[model samples]
Target chain A: MAADWIVFWVCAPISIGSAIAMLLQRNAVHAALFLIVNLFTVAVLYLVLGAPFLFAVQIIVYAGAIMVLFLFVIMLLGVDREERLVERLRGQRTAAILLGLGVVGEVVFAIRAGVGFSTRAPAGFGAANGGGNPQALGRLLFRAYFLPFEVTSILLMVAAVAAMVLARRRERPVASAERRAQEPIEPSEPSEPSEPREEEPVG
Target chain B: MLGQFLSHPPVELGPIGPELVLAGAGVLVLLGGALVRRRQPRALLLASLAGLTGAAVVSVSLWRWRGHATVLGGMVQADRFAVVARLILLGVAALALVLGHHYFERLGEERPEFYPLVLFTTLGMTLITAAADLILVFLALEILSLSLYVLTALSRRLAAVEGSMKYFLLGAFSSAFFLYGVAMAYGATGSTHLSTIARSLAGQTGNQALALAAVALLVIGFGFKVAAVPFHMWTPDVYQGAPTAVTAYMSAATKVAAFAAFLRVLMTSFQPLTWDWTPIVWGLAVATMIVGSVLAIAQTDIKRMLAYSSIAHAGFVLVGVSAATQEGIQSALFYLLAYAATILGAFGVVMLASGRGEEHTSLGSYAGLCRRSPLLAGLMSLFLLSMAGIPPTAGFIAKVNVFRAAVDAGHWGVALVGVLASVVAAFFYIRVMVLMYMQEPLEDVEPDPSIVPRLAVAVPALLTLLFGVFPGLVLGLLERASVLRW
Candidate 1:
């Protein structure tokens, strides 16, 4: 019990602090790094809660893969450039701060009131009931939750098709031919050097 | 140890046959589009129609075979209500496809993926109506919403992108709220299945506040989807900005599916708390009716006007929901069918009247439409009359049934508000007709050259008249099918 308290105290502050830092960071990459730190600390907190499988998943999925993807998007879009802090809507910042404070107040109230809340697990749930075991989790997922699991795959497939449809580049045939005829004088342009090189051999 | 828990549970596919058929067809159509060198809009449209027809047949057969049974380990329920909702969804999907074909071709942006996306959305709607678990409901909602977000921006115009962005942000926020509500409900009741949640919640008063909070969040989530008041800011913009066919589909099918799921969830898992939630819905219904009707009268864009009109209709449906009776549920179902047919035809006329590039959706452009094409003007008038709740129209019958349900439940105030809203709504509906018939043509615009869009409008117009004249045909069927047995 003493060690559990020690681990919780150590991890909780780091998690909360990193989350705040993530919001305060100006650079997208820095914010993403802070997010990774927060996610990692949360994974450690999950470990302290005796759910080793959940801890591992939190690290592998959220801290590792998802954060990496976030970083990649940040770099690919060059969003690391400092964004203008100009307020687009009047009193937007004030409204946001008020809402943020309300959320904080709600969280504090929930924590303070939680001492009286019941902690007893529901029927057929707990560590002894294989809640911490990946094998048991997998079995339950495949058996009872099979329909939703399959539907998720369909959802991902739909997302992929939608993304391709939205982002795929359309080839303008007549314009492309006109551009090719005029490309010789602009071969040294840095933005599209490879495009002209690829057409040179074909031409 | 592994072998002990590895036994496979018996899985039944009959209850979910409609969803399966749609998913399979969607994937197949997607692959076919990729493999084909040229855009095959005709073939893909035919394929989508076939899939919808097949799904409808399966849904009807399932209704006949089992009537009501919890299938897939209580993840989904196969009931008469779900079956009827699926049939209505399939009808809307078919009409949207027919209309979309000509609309896309006219815009010169006919893509094969469009039909498959429609199929996937229909699949999501079917699953939503049948979902027995909160998790399944969320997944199905995401699937439906993701497809719709993409479809909304398919036009690739500035307004389309803006609309899609707004919709996507608000939809994601609502989904978060919904998931949080599910978590709270699960925490309070220790289960996500509707029947199990209800059973566990019965006579339990310890976590009443938490449960009430969950109910409020869930209501807010669904309110966003159905365009209830205060959560309806995105509706007019999204509706006016999305392609006409998509707007038509989203207006009709999304409302039907979301309301079906909302009714099922509340009627099953939250039925015991009716006294607590009815007043909330009552407030929403009154606000939505007044706001929707009054704001609609101020719109110049035809699409925006219809968007507000749909919001008012949503209010009427919520009145039935607030009634919380078997008769109320039946009337809501009848109203959905009638509204879907009438609105699809109305939007089809809007799409046709707007010439190429969708440049003529303003109210003034509709002037002198009677002289340009009497057939088109006549069809538009029929739809507008139905929308205004005039005699011998489906909307009138739908309005009467829902208001009667509210009155039966002793909510006379709500019923009165609904009648007043309808009277105000009639002004806008009539304003459109006067613009079409009484005024002279602003420009000598040629009628749509395509026959498919004309047929699309004609079919739904005919159905509206048929249902209006013979309300019993749908009402009787709904009366038998509306009881959602868990």
Candidate 2:
């Protein structure tokens, strides 16, 4: 348990530091890297929390995929501006410090109050099914939350169409009134003599 | 085999027939929309309109049916409470469709997805109001929230995009807090089912600190949804920026659904912890009422003012929830119905007057409306009066019911605070009325002869009077609705 605490203490600074760096870093690519580090640390934390599935998901989806997308977007945009450290005014700096302190205080209070961990037995205890493992989640998805899951898919489809519609600029169709009036005198070869096309001239 | 399987729980399928019908209609409309590409949305519109009417019929059919029962193995509930609440919700959905049809037509932004989403969200809201389990409640909240997020951004304007983003971000964050609270409460107790929690917590002593913290987190989460003070920073911006029709639907249906869920959770599950939460709720209720009313008077924009008015109404509903009495629940239900009609009508008129681009968000734009369109002006006045809790308006009866319930619950101080808030709120409502009727025309405004918006406004405006004068009608329906078991 003491070893676990030492491990947590060591990882905690790197995790929190990377998170703050990710938010404050002006260079988008560096921010993405920092975020990946933060997410990897989170996965480590999840492992400590005995949530192996969540740890895997955190590493695979968030650190791997989402950060890659972030990097890709940053590279595609080609914005390599150097980090500009923001000069905080005295009042604003004080306000920021106060807000940060308040948040820290709240966290301390919550910890002191012992409000985070469960007193009762954790979910999936002595049960065949567990808390949202891949298989159990799949079964729950298909059986209980099937309708909502289907609806989410529909929402995704709508979102795809909406993105396409919003991004694409299609031209409006015009009747070309003058072309219709001036170029319409010609007729295809007739089998028989046809009456001349009548025109009513405007006054 | 399916029948035999479902019969074990003895499902109350009859009560949920309306929701099922709406759900089916939503899918049908979506399919019909895809099939009829050239004349897209016409068929969808017809189907959704038919669906809304069908839902109303189903609501009426269940009106005579009473008592509490579970449906779909406790995933959904249908009782006297949900029946009346759903009827109100469906009615608002129908009006919203009418207003949306006209608004979209004028703006040339008609799409088939809008109506179906609205109906589905309404169905979700009905389920939310009757949810017995915490998981079902969360799912229902998501269903309602996601649809509204899309609806808020449907206009695709700059303000709409920004407002929807803010609303979505804040809403998701609040939901996280709520989910965490649910997790903690479930940890503290042994179940996610509300009744089980209630039963488990009954006779359990000590741990007041944890219990208070749980309820506080829960309140913070629900406070955002209901737009209570301190968590209401998003309400005005979202309301002012969203399409007026969507705002109308949200202000009415969303509030009713959230309050219903809030009351059920508190009265059923958290009643044992009442002493810990009542004072906090009382403080919140008073603060919300005063701040909502006081701040509303300072707003120049009409939509912003109404947004604040909604916050104040939320306070009133919270008062009832705090009372934790059957009368309190019933009164809140009645108030919800009245407020739904009044706000919908008010927003309907706002939609009519604002034209394609919705430029009439400010209070000054309403000046000389009487000269421009007397019929519209009169309707707007009636809505304002109802909102102000004037006699013979549904708002008045609704407020009285809540006040009576609070008094009966021996919360005279809370009731007094509510009355004070109403008095202050009246000033702004009357201010709008005076602007519409007493002021002279400043600009040359053309009256838009759109029967859809007018009828939409008129029906609810008339209902406000009908129900206000005959409060017994809706109240009787509400009385027949059974509060859910803890």
Residue-level lDDT tens digits of model 1 in B1-486: 666665676788899999999998898888877787655789889988999999999999987755337878899898889989999999999999988888888777756778999999999999999999999999999999999999998887889989999999999999999999999888888788988877766768427777888899999999999999989999999999999999999999999999999999898898888899999999999999999999999999999999999999999999999999999999899888888988888888889888876688999999989888889999999989988889798888988999999999999999999999999999999998999989988876676867878987898899889989999877887998889765
TM-score of chain B of each: 0.98, 0.94
Angstrom error at residue B70, model 1: 1.0
Worst 10 residues of 2 chain A by lDDT: A168-177
Query: What local lDDT score does residue B107 receive in model 2, on the 0 to 100 scale?
Result: 72
Give per-residue CA lDDT, model 2, range A44-106, as digits (tens): 988776567788998999988888888887888786756556655758877988999999999
Question: Which 10-residue window in model 2 chain B sums to the lowest lDDT?
Answer: B3-12
Q: Who wins the TM-score comparison?
A: 1
The superposed Cα distance between candidate 2 and the true structure at residue B16, in angstroms, equals 4.8
> How well docked is model 2, in DockQ terms?
0.09
